[model samples]
Target: MFLKSVFLVYSLLVLRVYAANIMGLSPFKMSVIQPLLSSSKNSQIDCDHHSVKSSKRWDVVDMLKAMAKIDSTVGYEYEVMHWLRDVLEEQGMTVEMQLVEDEHQSVTGLARHNIYAYMGKTRDTSIVVSSHIDTNPEGNIPYHEIGEEIHVRGACDAKGPAAGQIVAFFELWDASIIKEGDVSLLFVIGEEYNGIGMKTAVESLNATWSKAAIFGEPTENKLSKGHKGNFRFDVEAWGKKSHSGYPELGFSAIEFYLRKANTLLNAELPYSPVLGPTTVNIGTIHGGVAANIIPDYVKAEMYIRVADDIEKVKAYVEELFNTEHSQMTIVQYLKPQYLSFDVPGFELIACAYATDIPYFESIDVKKYLYGPGSISVAHTQAEFVTVTDLYDSVIGYKNLITYNL
Candidate 1:
């Protein structure tokens, strides 16, 4: 008994050293385990030891701060990818980089890559946690702290959720509760402009048998039932240019755009009880060279938040455009995406914004959309996320993964 006790003490000391060195915990924080060794009950000592170790296994705040400081704007995620790769490798995960061709390679002359990390045995029934690594092109925005919030361009949009997902992954890995091939993490690019990265992943990765996939987006920590579809187009008008004073002498392209805009704004669109009514935004309009000159050409960009069948919506838009004289060119269209939420304790909502969900339609997996923060502030200059939300998401993701597994 005496020898057994001594060996157990020595083993615990070794574990403490390993946790301090390998787990990135400060020596001061590692000292919390010293008290557990003095307890008489072996089970109590083990429980206390695990509690201390888990608390210091990964620093959620530091990880989030590091991620927020990096500039991962769309088409420019190379540097951030390197940093993320190193972080995942340090946690003892097997990392894989999949090349993604840049659609703008003709202009930028460069390519990018997506990251995948996993452990344990590979299986078709693995759970996937995914999020985009790119942010809106907000330039070099620094992270700022205000009360309980952290302000940065991508903080609310996706980086916050990404960081939270990483922390949760680390927790599961450290606990050894999940075996290899049970869970995988994916970080993709091009979510802001297009879903090219996700599309590539669905094609390249053998993930068709995945049982469930959690897509991290800013959902204010609620589980989304689904989100609306998207359809975008450009309207162009052409007319003869003339002096503004003699407007009747030349047809005004600007006047044509205004008339069309008025008709679109007042037109009633189809509505759904589950997904809500279709909404439209005439996002941009440009015409005229000068105030004194009648414009020869004008173009307006519009996006529709589609609620139901995208084909029917397209037909409706086509009929509407046919009634007008302007030329309409379709840019992009995506059908509505519905997600699953078997895990309990979340309020369900239908998101109005679109995500990369539609891009993974070919992958035969149960999809889920969730995360921290809010979409309302995602692309705004004042974008921010609560530090509390970031921490809570770590727990939320862990629960989702645990439940699915």
Candidate 2:
């Protein structure tokens, strides 16, 4: 243990000393793993000779075309994964599919693979830029496309960001800028439900990874320092199975839940100035056995998005329900969870949604929330990523790398 502490202290000092030479951002906490990209004078090994001549705009558009062409919703990323693996293989890049067991088998229904296409064992590792490959479940969602407007699913929330990362990494790698090491790319899976893919990867503790992790979410490609997260749990109202005629034999769990919901609506949750406000939305609710029979069970799914002590928030939620719905049963509990990004110079907005950042905090990495398109267009029937936005993301990404590494 003493030796470990000594090494940890040494690591931080080494990284701090080298960070100034490379202009890379340091982590919030002490780092034990120093970057291997550092050199004698300057870490910015400019090898513009190995640069590719492809326009990032066209690259993004092409990637959107490819991502939009496939459907990787929940249990079905295999089709798109195979196609992407083939594309990477064609470029002589080594591709591997990280298969993680499905923990949420009752919900996800199948195992998933976190696809990776690495350029090589680059020794000049600078920064690890990553984006999620899987997309939200897009079913019979209606969309439109006008002149120059290309409408499709997974166009923004991720596909475009993924495109930007892929495009940039390939260019740098091919140009030999990343020949020795210093940079790598990581594309994860299962960001929506639970961070199963990232979790699996972290467990592997692969040595050939990057120093810091740049996570791409739909943030208009702006660098976010850090933000809040959540741990969501379920609160259930209980009743009894009885005949409809014998109303007294069963209490209405739905009614109990409704009562609890009314209280929450009237309550004002604590909020931080930075993260804005704490809010809750009961997205899904179900109760009753049949129209004639008195329902024995009722469940209400609670979603709480927060920037402060999310675990405390979860406890508060439980207290809120338990105090009111005293007789109710909690059929299921899913705590509100995610790590919010906060970056200076970034336009702050209330993110009532969730991301994969929370699951990644256990690893020593730099988290950036940036991507193409607006979150407003995400999961919408008319979902689409602006061609201009995709190009903009590439430029922004390059700028981020230029600033940090």
Please name the candidate that would achieve the greatest lDDT relative to the true structure: 1
Residue 6, model 2, lDDT: 100
What is candidate 2's lDDT per residue for 1-405, written digit by digit as tens? 999999989877876655433322233321334334433432232111011122222256666664555566655665566556655665566677777755365255656677655556442255767777777775633334556556777777677788887776666666665554566666777666566677676677363444566777776555554455655556677777777898898777776778778887677776766566777778678888688887766776666667566667666666777754443343332333333343334453445556666656566556566777777888777777777877877776765554555
Off by over 4 Å in 2: 1-58, 102-111, 122-124, 138-144, 205-210, 243-246, 291-293, 321-350
lDDT of 1 by residue, 108-166 (tens): 45567899888744634478889998898756556568999888778877888998898
Which candidate number maximizes TM-score? Answer: 1
What do the candidate models score in CA lDDT, each in turn? 0.77, 0.61
Reference-based TM-score of each model: 0.81, 0.74
For model 1, what is the C-alpha lDDT against the true structure?
Answer: 0.77
- lDDT for residue 397 in candidate 1, whole number 0-100: 90
